[model samples]
Target: MNRERIIAIVAQARAGQATDEELQELADALDRDADGSVTSAMEESLQQGRQQIALPGREKADRMLADILETGQVLEDPGEEAETPAVIAPLKPGWKRYGRAVAAAAAILLLAGATYFLLRQSPRPEEAPVAGTNPLAPAAEGLPAGKKAVLTLANGATVMLDEQHNDTITRQGNTSIVKKEDGRLAYQPGNAAATGLALRNKVSTPRGGQYQVDLADGSRVWLNAASSLLFPVDFSGHERVVELDGEAYFEVAPDNSRPFMVKAGQTTVQVLGTHFSVSAYSDETLQKTTLLEGKIKVLAGNTGYQLQPGQQVVFDKIRAGSKLVPQANTEEAVAWKNGYFQFSGADATVLLREISRWYNIEVVFNGIPAGYELSGKIDRSIRLSSIVTALREGGVHCTLEDNRLIVNK
Candidate 1:
């Protein structure tokens, strides 16, 4: 049960020379000696020793054995194989006699491949971060304005509005607008002249918060968290057209002459007067247009399909045939707008990203764990620690450091 006996037994096990009975005895002694703090340590040590023996060369195995014996961290006894060649120990006056040899062995292991592997496999120490700061916590500071607006035209030219970061940019006719330096374009509508150039106007919400906008022709738009909208600065002569790159809900102004159109990626959703949600983030493989009211037509590539109220159409480039699939829970699709991460079994990466955005933290994984689907609702206003605690309860261990979330298995 003492360290010396443990080390001798472990050495024999590593050499692939220990008998079954001897291995069992070693395990018993280790179990008695190691408390709960080292539950997996003995097992890990055994595995590493076995790996060293199994490696192609005898020299490599000896180096591994030396490394283990010297560390004093390895289990004294690892159950089983013990065919280790006898090692000559110099005359030792006392415990100090082993110290110099152990140091030399450590240096030798560094020269061998085992040390390289161990260094690579070792878990990095967590960096000191802002204490008690939860990545998922809601910002104590109120809404922070997002990025600059870049208006794109059908001709492919782009115009940057509010380039100066001035709080007050332009006052035209009855429109009073403010452009904060943070790239947030805040507008107040007023009477507008017909001579003003009509182009698609877009506003994107960054990581912090969401915004709502009313289009020129009375259409109402709710831009969800981390989403953006593109509409006309003023309605043109024909149909009202705009583009979307993220999640947004629209209550279109019904004008048969000026049908509201949403352009998302390769697909276009045309609605006369309907409520629908479009999620077209570039990271997502599928573009979804979910109708909540009235009717809408989704056109992708060469085909066009009509969607009924309460129906969702999904288009994917990777899958063959029609990609549209109905979602059982439509509320989850629009949860971001409502201020929560409404996941009904979402993948880890996507789920983590949402958590990161809400908490304003980075994420790093120790391993590529299996994709686990979890269904839950989290308030965006809550602290990051609260969310991480919930995940830990769900069987995932994570720690926070340097504004980053690190997962450990």
Candidate 2:
């Protein structure tokens, strides 16, 4: 298909003047172009026959799309529709044509009244990102993070939580899956058999995504990007055990009679009830468990280490060797959970890696400069360019190209 022509048609749709055929054609274009790339993942599987079963909140999608097609109006919010009249302005003759405009239109289907897509490719930032990079004249943006995650049921079916879904998602045994307004997935337990074969459900956060889950045992787990948690539908055995592959902050429910345990990589943390966080990503070299309150035992190989409040245990998962640090920066260790990147002279590579995971972008380094470090507190909700600006301010030169951020010494 002529991509430019489709973009033009989508531009009309944004102004509320596209025909029903045009809208359907845009939908078809999006359906055929899911190559496991592109940022508008919310609308990718609509045509992949993945919608065999109706989604919880999908009944109104067709109607909404049809209404916009029939009448030139955008529904910005429920009970709050915006009247956007058409604006006619001609671009310069040599303006570069990009198909991201079409993807932006497709993103609007999932995000009603959305004017622009979040992850659209933009030009490499000049010395000044705000003044020189924006070709379409976007406002000064500090992009705040939103609810983003995926839920995998025991059957292997995956649900993208950031897209369309209703109050109640599913019923697994005695637990009811609920999608919260802020994009958190919670499991509510009913009076079902507490002791039986455990049916496990896993929730995973992609790169540049995070989510919170209320486990069946009344424990709350806040998951960082590139992390997954597997737990049963409800508490069954003498102990509650959940497996973690990435990073998570846990406020374990206190049941002294039945201990709660978290298995992350080669390390296991056993606690009756406590507030703590575990960072154990496979890509990272070290796994650190920081305790906030109460005492817990951490086991690595044959050695066992006990932790108290404000103490953290750092261990090399490969070597099975562990060390404990007192007066841990419990705040800095958990800045991600609190919606910030708190750094205190962190290494340059480490900072960039964390940025890559949170923003869902890749980082390519020109050279790793030794003895380079950065310190600051950056809001996780800010735009990619904002971070790039911060890095530049810290004497690390960088530029954003498409989905990858390139850094230079």
Candidate 3:
């Protein structure tokens, strides 16, 4: 389809003058234009025609979108009945185009209150609204994860670290643990003499929490949700080592005489000075170590693999084997650290697992297709309901009930 035609259709949709045929034509154009040209043209047209249309305010528009997403239907006029198409087919394969089309359609419908249209498939029959149960409405909102963690000192005492608490948290031997103003925990090394022993402290982030720590050795570590890092108060002895429980991104400080090592499960990542991320959640089947800069050697069992920038090493815990990916998707590997969920060809289970961890929710899958996969990016700062809405747009039929997420086929 040509750009001018797409713009005209978009303008008509935004002005509440598009016919059903034109809406279907727009959907077909979105599906055919894999390179996103049609979607971009539609967006541009929407932006250009915004001043011409008398739309609701931003807050009202947001409410409209939320209502539509939650109900999976257009807002009906005062007492008019909503019409249901005879056949509701399944969504097509390409989620990127589908998502864009949904967004565009949502903007048009919410802004102009145009005739209801379905850009893609609607929810299946089994997913219909039940009595006294709104599928998308959670008992309580699942807020986004924040800078919340616990610091365990060597004496078994714990200190809560969060936005409310700041300044010097405690002192461990010659290291002063301080919570910086920006919500990061930092270890300030003093010039005092040697202490009795180098005490080991642990910083752990529970589900729905994340934290960053500046080690005494000048290294920085960002812990993902449900992750922990165990390290000495000071990087004493021959090498600096930290034990990781879940996932973390590391920015190691250069120390030629001493290497920095991160031990997660049976896999060990050794580096002198580098930037990398290690994901070794116990529940996950594969342990991945992705190198973003410099170099590192991953030791899995008896084998060792050298990783360069943009490379990743994956170790299968069940199969007891390791593989190296030459061209790794580094953005997806460190998306958590960068405050987004970037899924590239990710399966439903994988995406839901991450969501469950970040939102601290339990997921119940009911007959979800085995090979279902999606690729998209969502801001991690949004509420769980918004994330669930995005998942639905991406063709994952799911609902948030209290703290549990139920996925239906």
Top candidate, metric TM-score: 3
State the weakest 10-residue window (summed lDDT) of model 2: 85-94
Angstrom error at residue 30, model 2: 56
Candidate 1 lDDT, tens digit per residue, 224-314? Answer: 5567777666675678788887778888878999878899887899989988888877766767788888989998766778887667777
Clashing pairs in 2: 143-381, 143-383, 144-381, 145-381, 208-358
Query: What TM-score against the true fold does each predicted structure earn?
Result: 0.56, 0.65, 0.77
Give candidates' CA RMSD values in order. 21.1, 18.0, 8.5
Query: What 10-residue stretch in candidate 1 is worst by lDDT?
Result: 113-122
lDDT of residue 13 for candidate 2: 45
lDDT of each: 0.55, 0.66, 0.74
Output candidate 3 Cα RMSD.
8.5
Sorted by lDDT (best first), the order is 3, 2, 1
Best by lDDT: 3
Give me the runs in candidate 1 sitting further than 4 Å from their true place.
1-169, 172-193, 320-322
Q: Which runs in model 3 stand beyond 4 Å of their true positions?
A: 9-27, 34-91, 94-126, 393-395
